[model samples]
Target: MAKIAFILLCHKDPEGIIRQAERLTAVGDCMSIHFDASAPKSEYDRIRKALDGNPNVTFARRRVRCGWGEWSLVQATLHAVEAAVSAFPGATHFYMLSGDCMAIKSAEYAHDFLDSADIDYIESFDFFGSDWIKTGIKEERLIYRHLFNERSNKRLFYGAMELQKRLGWRRKIPADLQVMIGSQWWCLRRRTIEWVLDFTRKRKDVMRFFRTTWIPDETFFQTIVRHVVPDAEIRSRTLTFLMFSDYGMPVTFYNDHYDLLLAQDFLFARKVSPEARELKRRLGVLYASEGTEFRISNEGQRLYRFVTDRGREGRRYAPRFWEAEASLGRERELLIVICKKWHVARRLAGIVRQELDLPVIEYLFDEGKTELPDLGGIQSTIEKRTRHRRALMRMLFDYHKTDRLLVCMDPRNFELLQDFCADRATTRLLEIQCRFCDDYLTGHAKRIGLAGEQAGPEAMARLLPTIRNDLRHESDRIADAGFAHLNRMRETAGPDENAVPLAAFLSIPEDKARAIAAMENLFSD
Candidate 1:
């Protein structure tokens, strides 16, 4: 068996890590884990106990603190790599695994690809003169420019930009120099690993520059690798079986797309939720038997076999929904309404109930399952409220019974709601724009003349009527245009009288010359 070291960096999800290790043990020669220093001691102890008696598993002594857009994660990764290299010196490749990652292909196929590729499989991109540099500037003038004009994070944008300039860093890469951006999660050959570690150790200035930088994990490895070997035959994309968000974060895979997942040509996927256990079991069985094929029968449809690893296949039956009995006297339809603020969601629930004459199932994660509070005294915080909104949006998309979805919030919040709805396969959406009554607007003079100050209530009131009218007009136009397009597509074009010979009529539209074509020419082999 080929030697491959698996290094997993974990924080909270120890169980997830154990499951991944068990799966990869069939392929990987050795596994190493580095726990986050900040994790609870009890949690760490539990993780240690879970790994007990596994001959291939080893735990790192030095723990590293990890946070969003921080350098600690890179430090932790390097530590794990060094340990793995020392323990398994003969290992040809180092495969970095996250607790969330899962294998999608057979071990033999994965090993074959790794051996054949020779080049490192890391997600990389070119970052020369990109907006990423502007994230470091902190000046008020530059910060305001980025916020109002560029539409970026006001504080971080200015901070990162300013820091880069002050450090006497090369603002631009030389014309001869090549730069590449890549994700930290990847598989690297032994030679590439040695080169990466040596270059980082030698470049003290670069190390110092990254120590306090935002999103160092994204930039550090990328900057170093590009500096050393710009032309290295590297696969600057993940070879793994799963697609991730732009930031390399795993996305939730649901049971509905089980067939689609099987069809994809990938070795592994990540972040499988506990809900997908049955799908995982079925996949395991399909891959276990080589040259065997499985067919799925759905509703009276012909059985079709889905191909699996090593040219094997398995049959997938139509999901037996009837096998799982529903509770007696269950609600036929349940519509869940979510808002970050308990009072806002409660108020929206009331409006939905009153307007649509349907009692909504209200969910507020921050607040327990209790009666809705009075709307008058409700205090709302942006962060907490947005979480509830997202949770509600996700629930609405997943639940089939949520036929009608209503969102009662500000314009910005409503936009997010619409985006969430579009992500899901659903057409039911309603928006209720919230506005403050004139009686509530007291002693606050909105400054219209000032550049930075907000516009006045009178100005807002004047704009509301026009906005509403435009919205109604736009909605009608869209509906009419859709119908017109559908009708045009359905209509058949008649043959033209002035038709040329088949060979000479290449320029003529086929729909226009349908009748006059010679029968032999039309049916030619």
Candidate 2:
């Protein structure tokens, strides 16, 4: 007989919370609700009144003024859990949920799944080594004293952190505990939860340290549970489906995402749109029904793709490139081969392919010409290409799972150059400047809709300075030849170094490995 006591930490949407409490209790489970102190009295009253008659529903006696990344959130959860333990002694498991969380699978499935294993489902990773914390102070969050609420007063919070840094003030963590972090939402066994409560009550110093630590809710139980539970009894996954945008905001489910929700194997999902009445109603009916077979989905990966691909709605028009970068995860090592002439690029690609045995993808950013022939046509317009540029590049990189990739792109593509320069950490630029700029000048003149669409010395001269400045940013990984006339070839062999002339470097080589060796030497500090 596996029974779950759901601890729902809620802040808003009284009607929605009441509906969730009713559905959970109706399915023979108990619920412990904690309304944030910031929530209006009227909203709290409405929820309490709706569930007053339900024996399975209980509310936390003490409300805490909870803010994002504040310790009060953890306090509120503890209070709610205390109330729940007293109210539902038969609860075999304690599951943490949020106000907007709704069951995606049936209650029968959750009970059967829990009954199969007394294992705890929580993502607890070593704080220092894990790359889980994408942004902000990772180790510093635990080391420094963070009293101010980041959500309420961001300036003051950061200012205090800076002050502590300048003053060389730091706090030592408890000697017995190892710092661990994960999603705040988790499912723990009753005995495990009891042990955690007892541990927290006895460990005043640990509690005091965490009192001002940043986002203690995400770390508190995660760190505590690891000390008691063996690794075999823990699963590094959450039953609830919670996806955050790369910017750390939760991706909310809407009415149209009903199918998306159904496809996910997660028992419950959170941050559902409050106005999604039809979605909630359909999922509620599914939650109460009996089901034995559970359809599996790689939803974590799928939702990430969803956020990157489908999340582009009116946001493509935004000026900031980071908006798009956030959707397309982290940067990977990328090699960009820049040259004015396509013929030069083709020759270089062939040499690298045959000689160095390295992969060479040609004209990846060319209009109507890409490695992905199927996704090539959209490059006709600058807007279309700019919007889909990072996504296209990300797909290209993903398709070829190699450490280094050689991609040929037109040097005149300022937008592409800007993007490459912005992510200097991973971008390796190799530019082969052609002596005869007439062809490139004419082509660029035509593209910009220049008068008479003809190449002139003046037009070439005007464009040379801009191109040179864009290519040679300080401390960027770059190698180049030619462009002596523009007066900015930093490491190019001077006219005196006759052995490796610009024209000779471009010529077809009999000794291919030696030619590749010479190219590598160009990038020398």
Candidate No. with top lDDT: 2
The global C-alpha lDDT for each of the candidates, from Candidate 1 onward, is 0.49, 0.72
Q: What TM-score, over all chains together, does every model reach?
A: 0.50, 0.62
Each prediction's number of clashing residue pairs: 18, 0
CA displacement after TM-score superposition, residue 290 of candidate 1 (Å) = 5.7
Best by TM-score: 2
Candidate 1 per-residue lDDT, tens place, 433-508, comes to 2223332222111221111123334434443453444334433433343321111100112223222321122223
- Per-residue lDDT tens digits for candidate 2, residues 1-525, read 789999999998898898889988898999999999898999999998899899999999999988888899999999999999999999999999998898888889888889988799988988888998888788779888998888778899889999999999988999998989999989999989899899888999989998989999889999999988888999878888878776778988888776556556578898788889999998898888975454353344443553374345334344364534543334465666676566766765676677655667787556454445345555455466566766656655566665456677765454465565565335555566544344554454445433123333553454445434443431132223222211112234443332233223333343443445355334321
Q: How far does residue 394 in candidate 2 sit from its true spot (Å)?
A: 23
Q: Point out the worst 10-residue segment of candidate 2 by lDDT.
A: 481-490
TM-score, model 1 to reference: 0.50
